[model samples]
Target: MAGDRGAVRRARDWTRDWGRIWGGAWHRGDGTILAALLAAWVLGVSVWPLARLFLEALAPGADGVPLGLMAEVLEARSTGRAFRNTLAASAGSVVIATVLGTVLAFATGLLRLRGRVAMTFLILSPLLIPSQTMALAWIELSGSNSPVLRPLGLAPPPGTTNPIYSGGGIALLMGIEHMPLVFIALRAALATLPADLVEAARIAGAGRLRILTRIILPLALPSALAGAILAFAAAVGNFGVPALLGIPGRFPMLTTLIYQRLNGFGPSVAGQVAVLALILVALALGALGLRALVLSRLSVPLGRGAALRPLDPGRARLPLEAAIWAVLAVIAILPMLALVATALSPALGVALSASTATTANFHEVLANPTIRRAFANSLLLSALAALVCTLVALPFAWLKVSARAPLIRLLDWLVDGPWVVPGTVVALAMILAFLPPLPLVGSLYGTFAILLLAYLARFLPLVLRPVVAGAEALEPAQDEAARIVGAGPLRRILFVLAPALLPAAMAGALILMMTAVNELTLSALLWSSGNETLGVMVFALQYEGNSTAAAATSVLSLLMVLALALALDAMRRWLPPGTLPWRD
Candidate 1:
């Protein structure tokens, strides 16, 4: 019996080895699968819908007018002005966020800044606040009757001034929303730099400014550029800021322009919107491609057993550090305070007008039926979607990182396709993909299931990236040892792998949930009555001219996101300080 068992095991090993050599070489096959999945996802999400919208726009009418008449309406003076306004706002936002993010990261990471922890938290805190709240506060400060301005003699006194509601206001909102990306990217990049190299240059008497401009800047430039590109893309795609701050002023970017073409102009204008959307797609792809290219070229590989260094805070650096700390703190605090103030205001739109403001908005928001429905829907749908995504994502991630199969490699490309695809495109494709003979499970054409699938496509990367990283950090010996003790595959996974992957898995899920809750573009198109998420409700209120309700819904969305971000931040600290699978 023992001999027979040994023979069977050997035979299985031989089969696997042959399979690895000929049909399914580990990572190669994995890469193939990844590519295929990526292709399927892109076709089903971005490419297909874009084609549909474009075709609809190009379709001719009985009167011989092209269906894309919406373009003509948008090309009018008002639409033209809005387009320029969006470009100006997006450009300004990208510049501001990139500059501030780089400076803050360098100050905190390289300079051994005082109050670093507090400063870091402050820079990141605005992420917890909704952009709508910021708009409200800024509006208050700019209001002719604002109490906040009275103290500083900054008020317009009786009835003459308001926050500049042009391109600048939109830019400011985008900057506040995007600043965190810059900080995170720069911080991570700086943390990985070889300190010994810097120390050697310092010992050789390199000046601080010279060292930064010559060495630090060049080394960090790729990461900074990558982050800046991402920030730029985000600024370009943003609808909330443009809708809230710009739309009222009649300003429009490509995103808002696209929305107007579809919602305002009707189906006849679909072709023109499709053409414009293609432009947006091209720009987004270009940005993503540039970042990928730069990162690939600049990245250096570490050999086995590379030595690592710890950051040291020296006595002589205290004052410089204090200055850095102060800047980061101010940047972080002001915006958050503004949001909190707005959310707690008794009157939603009457910013800066009175000191009599109370928590009426919060109470009203909490009691509202739409708010309640959105909250429940957001929570349940996001949670369910996250779970489904995590499960689906795990197998894909495993194929990419572990199996090393050619097919899996093909699928890896599919995973990345969603990153470049537009949200609108994804929603449209899902609608098409689920309509007829191949309708998704449960007639999901108009149900929560479609939203879940859309989200999975949009956000599976969030869950997969971290989990794959965790899985890779784990050693094969752990599993082998468990198997030697008679543990089956399922038992070994349950006992050893689950705990190891939990942190990363949870991190991914939280990120996905936050994204799903806050997402607007796709949700706007895909969500139905049965699945009315927070974003859709907010959009509805905005359309109804009930800006207060919109603001309230936006506040709810941001608060929920803030809670998740804070929880994850806490988990990062509470977990042992290491990037490995399990630290002390």
Candidate 2:
């Protein structure tokens, strides 16, 4: 029902955008109208699907009660179990993330250490790797078939269930994945910590421990709490970690439950899944509200001043750096080594060596036409997503930061709606919204178009955020100078405005492409038979017991991501501040 309304509304938006932009944007000397139209398009991407999902969830259906369906869903044993599992896993992971992230933040952010930049990037590796790929790496690291661990006799015995399928393993990996959020937030908060305050504490007979307890932790607690809550929210929404681990391990989560129900029963279960999605939304919202309340109460906003100088560890410096590196290697480096070893092995449980290793897995991954097609599809879709997002974000971000267009600015907040929600929820919304036939176009379900649209909606904010910051940083005089010379909207944007924001736009687009290329959760649900993404293929191969091939494919995708990240780092000297997350 709501799908039809959404389709008509989209048609209207298309008409408006085409009629206003190409027909008149060049004729007029102003860009505001063009910006608004683009912003409207961005806004529509979020609204239609979400609206459809809500309507599907709220409709009386066969029953006449409004809230009865929700109650029924909430009361189901599986639903209750999923909620409890989600909270327990999230709670456990948040504790892990807080401890690791806060420790890393202080060690890297406050201490003077050799090779800090490299160590910091290594520490943040979990964020760069996709959740599914990370799950695979950990599985390979811990499973009975692990080449790396089997050599050391540390692996669980064969015929024993792999321990990684347990709830504890899910929490451990998720914690590592989200640790960077807390690290970044706490570091940012610590950046504002006044050196004078620390210096005074030091001068007043305060030791390092006393100063840390009295001064640093107090000021940094609010941001750490905020980051922890963000981590908790993220854990609740995570699908890949639990899907890969939880399903085989028999640990049910809301994300896995939704996927299983929808995948098994199709869109007929969307209403029921929508109820689960609402639970996820509620958990995320509750986290946000808790953060705001905590910040309001506990936050001690301090004046900006000279940052505290890096503390010297003196006699402990070498040991401190070595310990940090060791921990990072165990968490970030060893699992990947295990994954690569598995990829190179001839078969499962085979140890890797120059004499024993074979390239058969790589050959299968690369030479298989279907697998090749999946790779091509992923690359093409990601490139398109990046290109389209970059084009749309330029105009929308300009108006968004300009402060002159209140309406556009108001609608801009909707961008985060699609981004922050669970990937499963967004994919479900896409299914519900486009499964039905439209006025001119037919049903988008099982088509390539839906995947592309989902990528756009999911990633536009990633591109727009940096561009908005770049736009905000621009001097109005530069734009005004061009306008004074009678330059048209297109001319000013192409010639004067775009050049200034190119670095930011490119960085965002690159990151967006990297993210979309190896995405598993959305593609897992949205992919059709011929349109398998790399993520779906790897997941399928692993599920089908082709572990070697899955590892090979995952390695290829991870290499692409790493290569792009390195390229971005190489180019970051020319980009704006905050473009690279790991940069000092």
Candidate 3:
């Protein structure tokens, strides 16, 4: 009887301890609640789905933990060809992008060139345009019945097929699409170049070419390598370019191959296709790892000094400026003009003469119920995602800066997993995780919630990064003062901290909204009937041979992007440096 009483006493003590722990978790000063939310989001949106995909690939048909499926996938002829094609196209595009981007960066960042700001905007316009739209514009510009070419009597022969429907064409367009990444990286590096070093070299009688080759190139090499790796990763994961250009030309990359298999054979082949997704992930990760290694070994530390002054081109400035304009014309203006022409054409394949030009395509798309629904849906999703992500980012950023919890730091790292992983992989994981009825939610597979959840997961990092920057720059004295005045943690955050971080949060939300509105890859797999996004509708119209409608939709989408960019540009005076890409 005494021993039983002792056991009961121990049980009571354990219950009291548990209650204390639970109470601490609910306390406001500690970041326990915020940490828990972040953990839940990371697991539900990223970790769970990725783990399921890996498991499905490795253990198909209940055969537990075997390499047989992976080996078979690797050995398949189709897999081999697609892998090679992906590597080749990625490498080719990286080379092209690096060259073009480096030249543009030097001219705009280092040279005393005319209209540099406008040129920078034009050069980066591809980042605003969707990959599929870029591919479509190129197609319209190149085909035998090309509106731009046909008007000048320079159209290719009738029997000649569009050259853009080939692997080389995919590489070309992908390079153009990703050039901005390299340009931005190199331009940033150039902005940090020390004027003292360049001036000393010039004083030593070094010529322009000598200083450029010996001094500038070496210092910029690390950024160039980093940019090359980014371009390569983007190329490997790109679906729109491969889908629009490669499939028709019989050149399939891993992304497109996965789409084709799952789409054609349904979920029955999911495990098999997941093997392909794994390969893509491996390739992208490998490139990123290489980038890290190279940067670690090759990075040059610069002394603090004034920035390098722009160099004059003397008598050559006019020709160089003309060359820059011509390149921009080919990459930006021509394709846009072709898209406009196509949108104005009476029908597909019609010549864009004065008589054939009309606003019928734009009017028709605007009036269509389906198109209107898609626009509304896209706008709503993008806006909600931006607002929600911004809200969540605030507390998380606070936790990251103020909390010393190991779990908070770990969660911070894990949040980037969804952003870095290919969208195809993310979509596949989402399908695998949510295809069945969720506990209280029922099936989310066909609902708009799935898309919203994916967007939140994919874009949370965008909002988090900027807010963290703002939080890190903040002085902790104010919060401490508020606390000493008897203000609670919640009151301090709401009244003291929120106002300071509002601008950065707003900027991040604007960027997220623009990015998500025309997003393709995530929506490509997640979208269903009556739940179409602008990207899906554009792809569908093009696939159905309604090029005119597709062009009109693309034009409208581009206009929105430009309008947002302009709005941001107008507000750049009040924003911090580096907040707006075009402004920087």
Going through the candidates in order, what is the number of backbone clashes in each? 43, 0, 0
Cα error, residue 352 of model 2, in Å, equals 2.3
RMSD of each: 8.0, 5.5, 3.2
lDDT of 2 at 459: 89
lDDT of 1: 0.65
Off by over 4 Å in 3: 1-28, 60-65
Off by over 4 Å in 1: 1-86, 126-137, 145-147, 155-161, 265-271, 296-331, 348-357, 431-446, 477-496, 528-530, 538-556, 573-584
Off-target runs (Cα >4 Å) in candidate 2 are 1-32
Q: After superposition, how far is residue 214 of candidate 3 from its true place, in Å?
A: 0.9
**lDDT for each candidate structure:** 0.65, 0.87, 0.86
* Model 2, span 389-484: residue lDDT tens: 898877776656643566667767778888888888889999998899977999999999999989989888889898888998899888778877
**Candidate 3 local distance difference test against the native:** 0.86
lDDT computed for candidate 2? 0.87
Q: How many residue-pair clashes does candidate 2 contain?
A: 0
In Å, residue 151's CA in model 2 sits off its true spot by: 2.0
Candidate 3 collision pairs:
none
